[model samples]
Target: MTRMKELRKKKGFSQVRMQMLTGIDQSDYSKIETGKRNMSFEQCRRIALALETSMDYLAGLTDQDTPYPRTK
Candidate 1:
């Protein structure tokens, strides 16, 4: 499974719930998750926030699941 899908499932969030959280349409989110579409930087940021994970982890840049510290 893609890291995004894995994290979303780990958080017990459905695609509908993801839409509610990230303002991304469920169908579009599904496409993003299934690799049928690409997410923009803003979308990635919103999704990372909603999933409580870091973009690095989502992008496979890091194996750590923890989010990085946020700056003010």
Candidate 2:
């Protein structure tokens, strides 16, 4: 599975549920998890917030899932 799918499953969120949390359509979110589609910066930010993880982690830049402390 891709990193996105792995993390989503780890969070116990289905594509439908992830859609609800991130405002991304289920099909679109599915594509993202499957690596068939790319996410925009805003989408990435929303997904990171929904998953409580770093954008870098979601982008496969790092293995660590812990997010940085919020600045605001």
Candidate 3:
């Protein structure tokens, strides 16, 4: 499973709920989670935000799941 799917499940979110949080359609979200579709950068940002994680974590670029330091 994709890290997105793993994170979603860990957070107790279903595809429908992920869609609701990410503003992506349920079917599209399912495809993204299942690795059938590539998500755009904006979609990744949204999903990361919704999951309270960093884009790097979602993309598996880093094992650390904490978001980067926020700057105002």
Return the top candidate by lDDT: 1
Ranking by TM-score: 1, 2, 3
Where does candidate 3 stray beyond 4 Å? none
CA lDDT of each prediction against the hidden true structure? 0.93, 0.89, 0.89
lDDT of 3 by residue, 1-72 (tens): 378888888999999998899899999988888888999999999999988899999888999988898889
Task: Give per-residue lDDT, candidate 3, residue 25.
Answer: 96
* Candidate 1: tens digits of C-alpha lDDT, residues 1-72: 299999999889999999999999999999999999999999999999999989888888999999999999
**What TM-score does structure 2 among the candidates reach?**
0.93
When summed lDDT is taken over every stretch of 10 residues in candidate 2, the lowest stretch is 1-10
Model 2 bad stretches (over 4 Å)? none
User: What TM-score against the true fold does each predicted structure earn?
Assistant: 0.95, 0.93, 0.92
User: Residue 31: error of model 3 in Å?
Assistant: 0.5
Residue 52 of model 2, lDDT score: 91
Better of 1 and 3 by lDDT: 1
lDDT of 1 at 67: 98
Root-mean-square deviation (CA) per prediction:
1.0, 1.2, 1.1
